[model samples]
Target: MFDHIQIKVKDLKSSKRFYTAALAPLGFTVQYEGGGAVGFGPKGAPALWLGEGDSRGSVHIAFAAKDRAAVKAFHAAAVPAGGKDNGAPGLRPDYHANYYAAFVKDPDGNNVEAVCHKEQ
Candidate 1:
């Protein structure tokens, strides 16, 4: 339903590194980079855009993962890329019976998350 999202970060390079690793496990990659911003998504479409600036406020974004393992992988990748662990991978029954997810705070303090809802 959403066309794309743009997040403002204090440092462009650092945000790039954090996102590159964190999203890799979920099959997202940098699709374009120029004009002081970078766009990430599958093959050709860039759904997430990171721009250089001082963030007015922290943003929360959640990507869909194929399964639980992908959620775990995203957490592992995020930590080393300057992300702080917001939540470990687990099934949140409160959200629903099969709501598996993980959360991380990006370098710019954005709340990033990956979630899987398929039954397994």
Candidate 2:
């Protein structure tokens, strides 16, 4: 429904590092960069973008994972790379019977999440 989403961050380098590691587990990588902005997603499509600027309001971005393990790995990699834990890997029965997700706040306080919707 969206072509891409952009976030304004306080530090470009730190944001880049955080996203690079966090999104890696979900198969997203830095696909393009310039003008103090970095784009990430599949090799041919840019879905999430980060740019240098004042931190904006908190935004939630969720990536679909192949399975529960990927959600765990995303949390593992994101925290050390400057992400703060918002929600640990677990089933959110409130959202759905099998909605397994992990949430983390980026350096700029953006809510990033990875989710898997398969029974486990």
Top TM-score hit:
1
lDDT of 1 by residue, 1-120 (tens): 898999999999999999999999999999999999999999999999999987899989999999999999999999999999999999999999999999999998899999999887
- Per residue, candidate 2 scores C-alpha lDDT tens digits across 38-90 of 99999899999888897648888899999999999999999999999999999
**RMSD after Cα superposition, model 2:** 0.8
lDDT of 2: 0.94
lDDT of 1: 0.96
Best by lDDT: 1
After TM-score superposition, the amount by which residue 65's alpha carbon in candidate 2 deviates from its true location, in angstroms, is 0.7
- For all candidates in order, the CA lDDT equals 0.96, 0.94
